[model samples]
Target: MKNFLSALAVSAVLVSCSKKEATPVPEKADTAKIVDSINAARTKINDSIRSKNHFKDFSGPHTFTHNSIKNPGSVHFEKIKGEADHYNIKGDIKSGKSYVHIDGFMAVVSDKHMNFTGNISESVAGSENGKLYVRRGTKTFMSKDGGKTYRLQDMVNGSGFVEYIDIHF
Candidate 1:
C-alpha cells in the first residue's frame, strides 16, 4: 500500500509538471499593406508641396505653380539685353505700414528649371518700432515633370529668415 501511494504521488507531480499553456505565435506582417501606407504618405507630402500660400508665407521647401503665383503681389521680371537666360526679377509685398522688397537675378535653365541669385530685404514701420531685415543667397528651383510642379534645391541654410521663398517667373 505504501509503495502504491508513493507511485501515485510521483504520477500526480509528473502530470502537473507536464501541463503547460502553449505560447501564441505572432502573425506575419502584410507587405502589401505596408507599401500602400508608405505610398499614401508620400502622395500627401507631394500634394502639399504643389499647393501655394500667401507671399508672406512663401518660405522655401515648397513648390509653386505658375497660375497659383499669379497676382500675388507686384512681381516683375525683365530679360537681360545681351544674356540668353539672365533676367532681373523684383517683387514687392505691402501690408498697411510694412513692406518687403525682393530683388534677384534669375538664370533660366529651361521652362521647368531655374536659378535665383539675390537678396530679400524688408523694412517694417509698424506701430511699435521700425525694423530692417536682409539676406542674400543663390537657390536653384526645378521641376521633374516639365512646368507642373517646381521645388527648390539645397534647402539647408538656404535663408536667413524662417525659410527660402520661391519666386516664379
Candidate 2:
C-alpha cells in the first residue's frame, strides 16, 4: 500500500512537471522600418506641391497604358489611396496630407478615414502588418500587408501629405 501511494505521488508530480510553459510571443521585428517608409513617402508628396512633376504615383493606366514604364504587368495587388482630411490642433489647416508612398505605386486604405499622428504602422485588409516605410532615396513609402504583400497599380497622387482628400488614384 505504501509503495502504491509513493507511485501515485510520483506519477502526479511527473504529470504536473510535464505540463508545458506558455511560449512567449515574439514582438514584430520591422516596426522602425515601416515608420521610416511612411515618413519618406510623406516627404516626397510634400515636395510635389512646389513641383507638380515631383515623384509621381502610378496605377493601372499609368502602369500599363504608358509605354515608357515596365513592370510585372498589373500591380502585385491593389492598394487604394485614402484621403487625409485632418489638421493640426493649433488651427492650422493641412492643405493636403499624403504621408505614405509606394515607388511608382501607391494605395489609400478606404475602409474609413485614418488620422496619422507622426507614428504609423501598416494596415491592410484590417491587419497591422509592419512599419510603413524605409529609405529608397530621399523619401519614404508605405507597405500594407507586411513587406511580403502588396496592392496592384494603386496610387494616391496630388498632395504629398495624406488627408481625407481624394486623388487621381
Candidate 3:
C-alpha cells in the first residue's frame, strides 16, 4: 500500500508538470495594406505639386492672409522688373520676426493669379528651387521644387488649411 501511494504521488507530480500554458502566435503584417498606404501618400504629394503648377503662369503683386481661427499673419508679394525679374515676398507671422524682403523669380502673372519660383537667393522657407502660388481671394500654396511638390502654408487653429483671405494677384 505504501509503495502504491508513493507511485500515485509521483504520477500526480508528473501530470501537473506536463500541463503547460499555450503561447500566442505572432500575427503577420499585411503587406498589401502597407503598400496601399505608401501609394496614397505618393498620390497626395503628386497632386499638391500639380496644383502648384496650375498657377505657374501668374505674376504681379499679391497678398495672402489666413482665413482660419489661427492667426499666422500675412504674406505679400510684389513683382519687380529689373536685370532679372523677381518678386519680393514679405511674410508677417504673429509668432516671431516676420520673413521680410525675400526674393524669387516671378515666372508669370495673370489678372487674378501669380506664381514665384525660388532659387538660392531667397532666405525664406521653401525658397530653394521652390514655387509659390496665389489665387485671388482663394488659396495659397508653396512648393520646394518649382511646383513639382507643394504644401498649403495657411493654418487653421494650428492645423494646415488651404483657405486664405484676399490672396489677390
Output the number of the TM-score-best candidate: 1
Regions of model 3 farther than 4 Å from truth: 1-63, 69-78, 83-86, 95-105, 119-162, 165-169
| Tens digits of lDDT, candidate 1, 6-122 | 999999999988968988999989999999999999987876654432112222222222221222345566666544556687777665555556678867766777777897665
- Models sorted by lDDT, best on top: 1, 3, 2
Error of 3 at 162 (Å): 4.3
- How does each model score on lDDT? 0.58, 0.33, 0.43
TM-score of 1: 0.41
Error of 1 at 158 (Å): 11
Superposed on all Cα atoms, model 2 deviates from the true structure by an RMSD in Å of: 23.1
Across 1-169, the per-residue lDDT of candidate 3 in tens digits comes to 9999999999999998995889998999999999999999999887666445333433444444433323334455554433122356554433222222323444333323334444211112322222333322223345545543333443231123343333333
Q: Give lDDT: candidate 3, residue 107.
A: 38
The C-alpha TM-scores of every prediction are 0.41, 0.21, 0.27
Clashing pairs in 3: 58-108, 58-109, 59-108, 59-109
Q: What lDDT tens digits, residue by residue, belong to model 2 across residues 64-154?
A: 1111122112222222333232222111111122122223323233322222223211222111232233223221224354432222222
* Top of the candidates by lDDT: 1
Minimum summed lDDT over a 10-residue window in model 1 is located at 60-69
TM-score of model number 2: 0.21
